[model samples]
Target: LLTPGLRGSKAPAGQNENLQGLKEKLCLMGDANSKNYRPACSLCPVNWKWFGGDTCFYFSEKEATWQESEDDCFSHNASLLMLKRKSKLISISQISQKRSYWIGLSYGVDGWSWIDDTKLSTKRMDWIDLSSKQNCAYLFYRKSRVYSENCYEKYPWICEKAAVQLI
Candidate 1:
């Protein structure tokens, strides 16, 4: 009701002075808990990592075939990681930590393509076999390169999807 005594802070006016003052003092002394800091809002799940600014990626710990991995991603409303930018490839490569991951690339009758059927010209890869034995592509044996491998081989995969804005 517009009381002058309570007009300054949103707090109850009495408790805030002591608590806020103490909290500020504690925060100044490196007490992280005193600030009640929270992590940034994340659209990705706890097990997923947000990458490329707009996508959420899930790096599987369990190995699966290309088809099985794709199926798993589909079940999660996502797809295998589809990358085109060399810079993005490098970013993921650093995070790969020397472990390989199946990407969304594969060879088909129409040449190499991403899972979404986008044609990928190979300025970023080599030894891309057109053989039916090794049609699926995986990432990070060498930094920033994609290598084709047997589609039936079991390997960890990455699933990616667009992060939705939570408003």
Candidate 2:
């Protein structure tokens, strides 16, 4: 029942440990000199989760093909989740215990890359298998890995968009 207050790191007794860890992990993220301190609470949409750096993430409850999922995200003016680091990917997966969610990665004929056409880093993919048939990526929470699947298959997805700011 506890929520993040405007300031301070207070939380209920049993929840403090998890909250503290989340705060610590989040501390390692985002720009230190950014103007907006906590944009998620005030700027992000109601259903989206604030993911530091003015990024709001929306986790879908329903399943859809990768293309369909991307279209859905576009409908909301967002894009498929496109994280690069393994630890960052796992952190987001931990929050979404629901199931695997389609991300913004795929293996095109040229090579593996994110939706924005950025190449997937070899160092980051070192531990991943990248099976031939499975081209699209998803956050596999049970294993804390970014596993791939056939893009035609259906799976729940995550959408990412910047928190709206009025300047």
Candidate 3:
């Protein structure tokens, strides 16, 4: 099947039918003015990750340090998961079962904050106390909880961006 946005100069017979099927299975088209309409759709192409809701998540299988993971996500025009809402956090936790992954939270001179510089809200976080030396935060998939770890430690990471429409 042809991947989205990779259409050839000429489609073989029945290609239009196949494309329709692909769209029905893999894409969710929302009203242009709806809250679900995402700006990222203009830039995203086929093979991009698509999760339900307004955000798309990319779970990296390769392990890397927290900084490295952040860089990788940046390269993809995304950031490590910020998880602003408790419901979003819980949904991500459920989807990432049993596989701890680096998130966007970290500690710096200013104190704990997301990579975007937003302060980490204790009221919304599910933190597990760890050693003072562990300054980076990760999602502990087994229990769907957040925990601190050394920033240099290598682990798989999750990247998130606004959901996009497949061209």
TM-score of each: 0.67, 0.70, 0.69
- Scored against the true structure, residue 68 in model 1 reaches a CA lDDT of 97
The TM-score, computed over Cα atoms with residue i paired to residue i, of candidate 3 is 0.69
Steric overlap count per candidate: 0, 0, 2
The whole-model lDDT of each prediction reads: 0.71, 0.76, 0.75
Model 2: CA > 4 A from native: 1-42, 124-127
Please report the candidate that would top TM-score against the real structure: 2
Kindly provide the TM-score of model 1 when superposed on the true structure, using C-alpha atoms.
0.67
Candidate 2 steric clashes: 0
Identify the candidate with maximal lDDT: 2
How well is each residue in 14-47 modelled by candidate 1, as lDDT tens digits?
A: 7555655544443223333767432222256678
Candidate 1: misplaced stretches above 4 Å? 1-42, 122-133
* Top-down lDDT ranking: 2, 3, 1
